[model samples]
Every structure is written in C-alpha cells, then in structure tokens.
Target: MNDNFLNSANAPYVAELFYKYSQEPNSVDSSWRNFFNSLNEDDLSVLGDFGGPEWKKRPSNIIDEISFDKTIRPAPHINIESFKSSTLDSIRALRLIRAYRVNGHLIANLDPLNISKKDYHLELDYKSYGLNDNDLNKEIFIDGSLGLEKAPLKEIIKILKETYSSSIGVEFLHIQSPEQKQWVQERIEEVRNKTIFTPEGKKAIYHRLVESELFEQYLDKKFLGTKRYGIEGGESMIPGIEQIVKQACIAGVENIFIGTAHRGRLTLLSTVLGMPYKSILSKFQGYLNDPNEVLGSGDVKYHLGVSSDREFEGKKIHISLVPNPSHLEAVDPVVMGKVRAKQTQL
Candidate 1:
C-alpha cells in the first residue's frame, strides 16, 4: 500500500495492516514487508533524533491518551445528591401508595385469634429509608385538581395516609393508566374530604349493623355448631354493600351482578338482595322447594344466588348474585361474562 494512504482517510486500515505485519512479517506480501521495514527504519531514526529512552515512553503515553479520549474520559457529570433525592422520592411514593396492596388482602392472616390489630409497617417506614421530617418539606406532585403543580411533600404523605389507612385500606396505584390512577385519586380524595354522613344514613348503617348482629346471634342459637360460614367477623359487609348498590343505582346502571364465595353470602342475600328470611331458614331445615327445577342435585343454600329488581333512589335496578361453587373465585369469570353480555345488549 502507498504511504500516502496512511495519512489519508484510510489511516485506521493502514494501522491495522501494520499491526498484522508486526505480528508476522513473513505472512505479509513481500512488497508490503519492504514498505513496513522502510517505515520502521525511518521511525527509529526519528526516535534517535529525539532522546531514545524518553521517545520510547512517548508512544505508550500517546496510546494511553488516545484510549482515554476515544473511550473513557468524557463522561457527562451527574449530580449525586439530586439523583439520590429523586430515588428516595420514588421509593417513598411506592411505600405510601402501593404498600396497601400486599397488606390489605381480604383474608390475610391478620389477627388469627381475632384479638389484636395487625401491624403493617413494611413500606411505611421512613427512618429506615434515611428520610426525616425535613424531607417532607420538599414539594411533590399528586394527581388532583392541582394538575402538574406540586404541593409540599408533607401534605401529599398526609393525604395518602388518610386515603389509604382507613378500616378498608385501598390499593389502586398498581393500575397502569394515568387517567385511571387520577380517577381513583380524585375519588379517594373526594371521599376523604366529604366525611359527613347524613343522619338518615347513619341510622341506616346502625340498623344494618344491629340486624347483622341479631341475625348471627339467632343462627348461632338455632343451628348450634352447624357450619353456616357465618359473617360474624365481617358484619360491616352488609352496610358496605348497601352503599355500593346505592352508588350503582345513582350512576344510572340498570344491572348489577355480584360474584363471591360462601363468605357473607347468606346475610347479603337476605338483607341486601332481599331474599326472604323464611326461604333461607327453610333451606337450613334440609328442605328443597324446587329440586327438580335445576340440574344435578343442588348446591348449599349459601352457594345459591338470588336475583331482584330493587328501587334505589327511585331508580329500578336489577341485581343478580351469581351462584358460586365451594371453590373460591370460580364465579368471577361467570359474573364477568354475564356483565359483558348485559353491556353488549345495552
């Protein structure tokens, strides 16, 4: 190759050729070997003109500088403190919002003996994460009416606690869509701020609570050791479901389908869905009124579902409790399919 090509755009290729020739000169073309030998002699003369020992070190130093410039030296500077603060903020937000998902399982081993309250500090620890009260003063964004603008971090944390740490803790932050997250945030915040329950509403809640307690007491006395799978611990489900049904009716939903396992089904059927007390009691007495109407013997009364068209807030809404087998979560797909069919019909 011509020496001029070494100084042209093909310097890298010539350098590679020289490297190969240095490794095995006999393997290279005779002309190329002669050219390389001439270049090597000229290089030795130049090195001799400059002091040989110092110039010998210069090649290694130049290679080091070239490697540094080409590969290692020009990294963009990052602010370590700012990066740390941002990471802490993300972790804190997850703790405040997403921790409820794991801690708030409906049938968790929270109070196995039903004695003491369960502790849930896995993600709620601030000191463990090197955060203090001073960190709360930093501004952060929440999905609220404020949009992209930030509020004090302390205020956001307070709102999260109030929104999430109630008797019924929620875990909606795992939802992916921004609009859905914002909707949940807005609704939670609304419920938090609108804390006033009307006198009639309070009375209704009390009535449901009393009725639930009385029903459990009656069944305990009448049945005596028979496994009703009673809603003794979860009496609040009665009033809670009433609120849901009321909300659904208010939202102009014409149909509501519920699918749950045996837990709390009897009380829900009788009290909320308006199944007759006599009918439920008749089933408990081992009598099947319409055995031949349905297929394959029958499920237990608790596993059976009831339907009703009820008037809520002066709106007629049809509600169906989809029957579930002894197996948990089996009715979920059945309920969903029914809901999809109803929606398609609508």
Candidate 2:
C-alpha cells in the first residue's frame, strides 16, 4: 500500500453509488440508468469487480497490481520487490501504485463521520502532562479529603486537561440534589467545586482557584454543567421526568418497570423516586451503610432502579424503577416482554 495511493479519496465513487441507490426508496430513480448505460465496453468493465480480492498485494508491475484491484488488468503473482531487479521495472511498479492510489484513498474517505478530519483527533499526547505527588500537598489528603478540590487551578487544569485533553466531552457528573429546594435551578448551577484548569498557566501545575472565589464573576454564564446525560448544568430536563416518575409512584403497582438508558436518572431519582443521596453516595464511597439495602445488580449511576409509593391524583401508585443492563435497545425488548406479562396477568 503506497501511502500516496492511500491519500486519494473514495468519496466520488461512494457518492456515485449513493446517488444511484438513493432513489430506490420508491422504485429506482431511473435518471442515472441510461447515463451509466452509455459507457463503452471497456469503460463498463470498470464497474465490475477487478476479478478477485487477492490482488491487492504489492505487484512487481505497479500497473498490473492496481489494475487487478480495480479489475482493469488480469493478475499474475510475481514478487513485487523482485520487480525492483531492474530500474525500468521499478518505475513501472511505481506507476501502478500511483494509478489506484485514489482507490485506497476513497475507501478511507468512505467513513461519513470522519470524512474531512485528518487522523481523527488522535491522542498524540506522548507527554503525560500532569502533576506528581511531590508537586502537591500530600499532607492535605491525610484528613480524609481529596485535595483535588483545593488544588491550585494550574495544577488542576494540568491534570484534567492532560487527562481529557483529547476527550471529546466530559464523561461524568456525580450529582446529589437536595430534597427541599424552591430554586432547584439555582442550586443545580451551584458549583460544588469550581476552578478553571488550563495547561498554559502560572507555575504550570501549582495553584488553587476555588469556586467561592470565582463563581459570582459569571452571573450570565449558561450551560454551566451541560452534558449529554446530566440532570442539571444540563439541569433544565428535570420537570418532565419528575412527572413520569411521580405518576409511577402513585399507581401503587408493586413493580414499576422503567425503560430508559441514561437520559436523566438523577432528577428522577432525587425529585421523582425520592431516592436518598446517602444511598447513591454510599455506593461511590465503597460502603453501603444500610446492610440490608439491596442495590440493583450493576447499573449505571443514572440507571439505578428505585421503588417508592406516592399519591397520584386520588390513588396510590407504587413506582418501581427496574434495573437496567448496559444494553439500551437490548433492554427495550425486555421491557416489552415485561409489559406483555403484566397484560396477561390483567
């Protein structure tokens, strides 16, 4: 595989295929039919498979090899490196490599998701640009508190930036909303701990910029903690989930069958199901304080099933959040089955 050939793109070929096939949602869009039919025999041959898949091997004659991939030329297996025996033969091989360079290029470009980007955000961070223990106050950690919250902004920034420098998005949010809250919105926006971590800073990785010191500066800052799966920061999504969860609770059904992946589990847990933060916190701290508390077998922080009773309209509804497997659509079928089973009982 000549690197040059790999540089060529397969987009044009793929676009052609898509354009020809897209019309098939109805019958076949007959527009391109006659246009492709007008090709000469040799040109038409290019549309067919070159012959077999084995010909991509570097060939002594470059022309023959690429021709083989494109089905343009018949393949004969001779040592490609051996073809370098003569200068003229080597040049011929180079030509073949160049000819179908676009073929390899096109195949790589076939990925619609990463069509334009080179290398695709490759994690080239060979330098583990982070802080070392000696750089921090180890004594501060002895009080049973993770000093990470108090670490200087520079240090914090270096650690997290290097850690997630190339990460497409923030991955986690350990949230525990309080029970009584009129300003749920305001409370969710409250930074439990806030600091900006940037690699290019004073003293490299040595500083503390606490949220208390810097929070009020941004009165209008929006999307403070917005994430794909978070309840707040991305917090505006709580009310809707609370409605569904509340409905389930009042139904008084012995079992509540929930069937969501990880959209907004926290709000549901806190506001709807009334799951205690202590229970969620206990799991994270490696200790379930309640010995008999039966935690659902491994579900995500958001996917934990909850059981509770609430008053819906005039009736009592028992809400049971079901334990979810990692599989989303996977759990969908199971929910369907559960629903059917319930229907049968009725």
Winning candidate number (TM-score): 1
| 71-149 per-residue lDDT for model 2 (tens digits) | 1111134232322122121122222222222122222233346646433221222112122344333211110011221
Residue 164 lDDT, candidate 2, scale 0-100:
30
* Candidate 1, RMSD to the unseen true structure: 19.8
Clashing pairs in 1: none
Model 2 segments beyond 4 Å from truth? 1-229, 245-256, 289-300
Residue 84 lDDT, candidate 2, scale 0-100: 17
> Best by lDDT, which number?
1
Q: Write the per-residue lDDT of candidate 1 for residues 1-346, one digit (tens) a residue.
A: 2111111122222333445566677655565456557543433332122211221221223222332211122113433334324423433433443344334333233354767655446555444444578767765432222222245667665554555554445566576775676566567667652357899999999999998888888988999987778888899889999998988898998899999868788888888889888878877888767875242565566787889988876898899999888786778989999999998998
Write down the TM-score for model 1.
0.56
